[model samples]
Target: MSSQLLMIEDDTRLAEMVGEYLGQSGLHVTHRADGKSGLAQLQGPEAGPLPDLVILDLMLPDMDGLEVCRRIRSLQGPAAQVPVLMLTAKGDPMDRIIGLELGADDYLPKPFEPRELLARIRAILRRRTDGGTPAATPALRFGSLEIDRDARTVTVGGQVADLTSYQFDLLVTLAERAGRVLTRDQIMEAVRGRELDAFDRSIDVHMGRIRAAIEADAKNPRRILTVRGVGYVFAKQQD
Candidate 1:
C-alpha cells in the first residue's frame, strides 16, 4: 500500500499545492484545514489507512500545533508511532526546540521548497522504517543504566525511569550504536527521526536533559561524552 500522509494546515492554497505534489510522489495525502476538525479526523473511529506521517502547521484556527502534536502523541496503540513533521513560520531556534521537546519528529521552516520538504519526509520515514540491523547483541551495563532493546526500555538500577518517547529512543540509539561518535546530524536523523537544520542546537539541549536523568553527575556527564567539534560518543562502559 502507498504510504499515507495527513496534513493539518489552515492555508488552503498551500495545502492544495502540497497535497497535489505529494500525491504525485506516490503518497496518499489527506488534508484538513482546521486544528479541531483535523484532530477529530485523526481521532475518529475510522482514521482510514492510518497516516504514515503527519505534516502539521504551527498556527491553527482553534489550537496551536504544539498542542495538537502533544495530543496526537498521547494517543495509544499504533497512533503513537505515526511520525510528525512540524511546519512552522517561526524560525527561532527555541521554537524548533520546543517542537522537538513536544515530540515532533522534525521541523521545517516556512517558504520551504517542495522538493526539500519531500526529501525530509522521505528521510524521516526511512529512518523510522530501516536501520535496525544491530552488529552485536552484547548488552552494555554501566552503573544503574541498562539498555534492553528487546523490551525497548532503560532500567536505571533495576527501576524504570519515566522517559519521554524521544528520550528513550535517543538513549537506545546511542547505546546500541555504542562507542561510535555519532554526529549531531546523525543523531537527529536516527534518534529523533528528522533531518538536521544548519542552526539547530536542540539536539545538544535534549542530550543534556537525558544525561541529567540517567547520569550520576549530569555536569560531568560520563556516559554520553561530547567529542568537541565532531559530535557525541556513548561510552558503553565508563572509564
Candidate 2:
C-alpha cells in the first residue's frame, strides 16, 4: 500500500502546497486546516485507512502543537503507531530539542523548501520500514555492552539500556557495519533514510546520548568513535 500522510496546518496555502507536493511523491495525502477538526478526523470511530505519518504545524489555531502531539500519542492500538514530524516557524534550538524529547520522530523549521519537506517525509517513512530479519540485525559488542537482534534491545553489563527507538536504530546500523568508516551521509541514510544536511545536528546529539548510556564515559566516547571530518564507526573491539 502507498504510504498515507496527514497534514495539520491552519495555513490554507501551505496546506495545499504540502498536499500537492506529497501527492506527487506517491503518497496519499489528507490535510486539515484546523487542529480540532484534524484531531477529530484522526480520533473518529471509523478509522478507515489510518495515516502512516502526521506532519503537524506547531501553531494551530485550536491548540498547541505539543498538545496535539500528546493527543496523537495517547491513541490506542494502530493509531498510536503513527509517527509525527513537527513543523514550526520557530528556529530556536530549544524548540527543536523539546519537540524531539516529546516523541516527535523529526522536526522541520518553516520557510523550508517543499522538496526538503518531501525528502524528510520519504526519509522518515523509509527508516520506519528498513528493518529485515536475522541477517539484517547487527551483532555489536562494546565493553560489556551488547545489542540483541532477536530481542531488538540493547543491554549494558546484561542490564537493559533505556534507549529511544532512534537511538537503537543508530546503534544497530553502526554495529552491523562495524569497523567500516561510514561518513555522516552514509550513517544518516542507513539510520534515517536520508542525507545529513549541513545543519542537521540530531545525529551527533543522539550519538552523544547513546554513548552516555552505553559507555563508562561520554565526553570521550570509545565504543562509537568519531572520525571528525568523516563520520563514525563502531570499534571492532572495546576500547
Candidate 3:
C-alpha cells in the first residue's frame, strides 16, 4: 500500500507540485491550505485513518506552525504521535529549533530541492517501519528507564515518556550502543543514514528534548551525557 501524507501548506502551486512529484513515487498526498482545515481533517471522524506523516508549513494564515505542532502533540492517542515535518521559509535557526522542541520530527527550509524533501520523508517513514521490527532484544533497560524497540516506546519509572518518532529512534540508536561516545555525525548517520552538517546543532536540540522526556532532571541528565568538545554517550550506568 502507498504511504499516505498530509501536506498542510498554503502555497497552492507548491502543494500541487509536491503532491504530483511525490505521487510518482507511490505516495498518496493530501493538501490542506491552512492550519485549521488541516487540523480539522486530523480531528474529524470522517477523515478515516490518519496519514502516515504530515508536511507542515511554518507560516500559516491561521496559526503559527509551532502552535499547530504543539496542538498536535497534545491530541489524544495516535493522533498526537503522528510524525510532523515542518517547512520553514525563515532562515532563522531558532524556528527550526523551536519546531524540534515542539515535537516536529524534522524540518526543511524553503527553496529546498524536491528530491531532498522526498528523501527526508522516506527517512522518517523508514525509521518508523524499521523500529517496529522484532529484534534479538526487543527492549533495552537502563536502571528505571525502559526502551521498547518493537513497540517504539520509552518509559521512565513505569510512566510513558512522550517523544517524537524521530527522537524515539535517536534514543534507540544511542541506547543500543550504550557506553560508546558517538559524534553528532555518527549518531545522525546511525539513525538517518546521513551525515550531519558540520555546524548543525539539531542533534543537540533533539538530545535536550529526549533528556527532558526521560531524564529525572533535564539539567543533570544521567542516561545521555554530553562530552565537552565531543559528542554524546548513553551511560551504561543510570539512576
State every prediction's TM-score relative to the real structure: 0.77, 0.70, 0.96
Order the candidates by lDDT, highest first — what do you get?
Answer: 3, 1, 2
Quality of model 1 by C-alpha lDDT: 0.78
Candidate with the greatest lDDT versus the true structure: 3
Off by over 4 Å in 1: 131-173, 185-198, 208-222, 228-230
For 49-112, candidate 2 gives per-residue lDDT tens digits of 7788889988898897878877776776557557788897656766666666565778889888
lDDT score for residue 81 of model 3: 95
Model 1 vs. true fold: TM = 0.77
Residue 84's lDDT within candidate 3 is 99
Pick out the ten consecutive residues of candidate 2 with the lowest summed lDDT: 130-139
lDDT of each: 0.78, 0.78, 0.92
Q: Candidate 2: misplaced stretches above 4 Å? A: 44-46, 130-165, 177-186, 193-195, 204-239
Question: Can you write out model 1's per-residue Cα lDDT over 77-156, one digit (the tens) per residue?
Answer: 66765778999775566777877777787788898999978987887676555447765555557767877654555777
